[model samples]
Target: MKKLTSIIAIATSMATAEVANAQSQYYKKAEQNPYTLVYDGAITKNEKGKVNIHPVKYKLNGIEIAANVYTPANYDASKNYPAVAVAHPNGGIKEQTAGLYAQRLAEAGYITIAADAAYQGASGGEPRHTDKPQFRTEDIRGMADYITQYPGVDAKRLGVLGICGGGGYTLKAAQGDKRFKAVATLSMFNSGEVRRNGFQNSQLNTVQDRLKQASDARAQEAAGGEVKFSGVANITDEEIAKTSTDLYREGYEYYYRTHAHPNSTFLYTTSSLLDLMTWDAAEHMDLIEQPLLMMAGSKSDTKYMTDEAFPKAIHAKNKELFLIDGATHIQTYWKPEYVVQAVNKLVSFYKTNL
Candidate 1:
């Protein structure tokens, strides 16, 4: 018993140390880029003959939503175009991977919009960073609402591509919202399954304990007390290196070191787990009757989520799971070679479906 207790203590200490580091290792100032994008090859200026980005805002449930709409080079509003809504990952803003994919899709002659989730990033909501599954799903629907109405957007040809947690929410959105004729997910992650069961089911035995924590947090919020939070605010280089999974180790480097953005973070209100714990992205997979394209890095630790969810879409039309050889989860986010492969696959998928 004594030796077991010591092991638990050491594990706890390591986890704490992982979350107690200083600010992001490579955070970029919001003023550095005119559009506040922090990814490589981001658009610095909007030119007439080139791909153009337009900063846009709309109301979702009375809250202001901030987004970037990218139009293809030499775009003409008078002509119809297929539009895609790109959903960012958990803790991601519209300016990171989502924006990168949005921009790339635009370059392929598709109009794309990447929006910050409600209650996160530049979007308006109280008790910021409330990461609820419902809100995230609604954000995708809202994107469809706004983009379908944009000039030259052909509503019948609309599609969506979601990354990581956003991919889960996109699945939820595409289930009921038929506006999205084609659905695709890159590095798909099932947020609820991971939250409830822990990554790789490592916390299977502590499910009740974490639920209690979430319950307590909600009670505190109800009493107007302090709002509790979860997730890492910062991580050290040593911690990043020690992280066992490629998903998290590479994720920290991408979000906090390599492709850092001022508005991106890994934090969320603890009370959100009340809703998240009981949700599952693959709940009604068959409801997604649209053509589906699910892609993931072959070497990603999170690839299991995609594997588990893809086969369940029993009724989906032309559903396929494409693996990017030798790429991990985070690599799909920024690595040029992997990004090119994913984008090419996306273009081909969207072209055939949309």
Candidate 2:
């Protein structure tokens, strides 16, 4: 009888704990805010003589794109300022790390703009969360198009910084777009290689199986059937804890917990894999004549991607690969020490090359 009672008690405790976890948010929503900047130290209001956030919208290939352009303190319309186009990670929105870096660069006197990919985040598109390389690469080019004409921007002095999967697309974009005089990547991720072969090639055996799933998803859309989505919509704390790789485990915590945002998510249209699987970010590396800088966490599990793409830029007359000491893949996103190192290095690189 005592054993039965204890079992029930334990079960009740577990249930209560799960309930609490479900109701709790790691990052609470700030009340009465015009902009949705969720990262630490985000600007609550636009104040003069300080870093100001301007929420702007523009049409990208006929689809409206939501973006935040950060202008440096005391920005004047007539004065010339160097500009940077920042690309967010695969599942990230402009309100997360991309905003953090944009704000940081703005603080350093550079005008930076970070936008959501057309089919994702607060942007508008049918069958939302479509993650395609071509669309993403165009997003980077779109930033260049918009920022170059932005007040006080010097088109010739434009630069770009892409994080995670954005890094991969930036490489492809720079291959053809000569507007970005300097190109840099943070914790670069080769989306095509990973999507086709799987993370670290762990899903290599299931590549054909995944491709079939994507094909089926596309067919469903064509037939006006249910739109199938892939990737995690929601993750339990327990599931996140059990995740094996540092990239995925910390990524879940970052996107779902610590730096959570409403518009950010892990899921993408399964059909996106159809284009993602066959594309490679490192292709046509020689076409990028601009100076390149690739930075990655030395201890990151995904550092292999950066390593693979860095050497392929053979034609970059000036190219440097920087390693942040003792930082993991996700650590570079928010950890203060790591972020400072990356920002400082980036400032120097852009100053020299841009």
Candidate 3:
């Protein structure tokens, strides 16, 4: 185990150092953000007069969940402010895109929080990498629970933004969680649908076989046998280079190479499929009565999910679907122009509705 840790450390350090050299001008200062791995426009602890980041932890269902809260510049606790909860994507933590969006929203004058899901990242849970749908949805609710009571937060003006798979769970969470006055999603990925039928419905024939695999894994646990796990355990640089899909290609670059963090992983327990395979993000979509804003890249292959889910929100009090022209799925996370457009739309949507 020690040898393995050293090897991973060497590899990740080498990767990040290369990135740092390519980005040498951005890191002229000695200090770094204590809470996040370096990425494009990542915040430093001092924030240099931008929003301030507060690293925090709170208990959710007996597990300690790690999160970062971003407050507006020159924040005044005496005055109430609108707040937003940003949910990270699958295989993501608070320090990645979630934190990026949280910080940007804070700069727009909204208090925002991005939290590591329990059992993932820096959060506490046994049998790490348990990616159950229910737990993920609860994680969003848990963020709302924590941020509403934060100093200077106006609970009545609360909003939420969920990215990728987190966007799917956010839809279900907002269906019944009334505290969030407005709900938004970016590049929403429906995990359950993909897990059951495979990406692009390419695995439609193997649905039952996968279900049996999950069932057997669950049975192993019941018998006190070895814990079975599944999912992408590792990726080769060559594989990433060879991949043709923009989503997977750029996703590997973002999560494993460029913006990699020790807490993120592509693995999850096989038993988690029991819930994930049966769930759908658009289920009970009519339950959401709050204002809604769903955005995605017009050129994203994953745009189909957002398109399918958006029209289902027929009963939403108010709703809009904005596509970032010419952007792909992963580009929205860090590309300067897309990120700027997303933040602009988000600021406007929240301001008008919240």
Which stretches in model 1 have alpha-carbon errors above 4 Å? 1-25
Question: What's the lDDT of the predicted structure labeled candidate 2?
Answer: 0.87
Query: Each model's TM-score?
Result: 0.93, 0.93, 0.90
Candidate 3 lDDT by residue in tens digits, 107-222: 99999999999999999997899999899999999999999999999999999999999999999999989998999999999999888877777678777777888898899989
RMSD of 2: 6.6
Where is model 2 poorest over a 10-residue stretch in terms of lDDT?
A: 1-10
Instruction: Put down candidate 2 lDDT per residue, 206-303, tens digits, no spaces.
Output: 77777888898899999999987777667667767877789888997888777777788787888998999999998889898899999999999999
* Residue clash pairs of candidate 3: none
Clashes of each: 0, 0, 0
210-249 per-residue lDDT for model 1 (tens digits)? 7888898899999999997788666667767877778888
Give the clashing residue pairs of candidate 2, or none: none
- Give per-model CA RMSD: 3.5, 6.6, 5.7
Deviation (Å) of 95 in candidate 3: 0.5
Candidate 2 residue spans exceeding 4 A from truth:
1-24, 30-33
Per lDDT, what order, best first? 1, 2, 3
In candidate 3, position 333 carries an lDDT of: 86
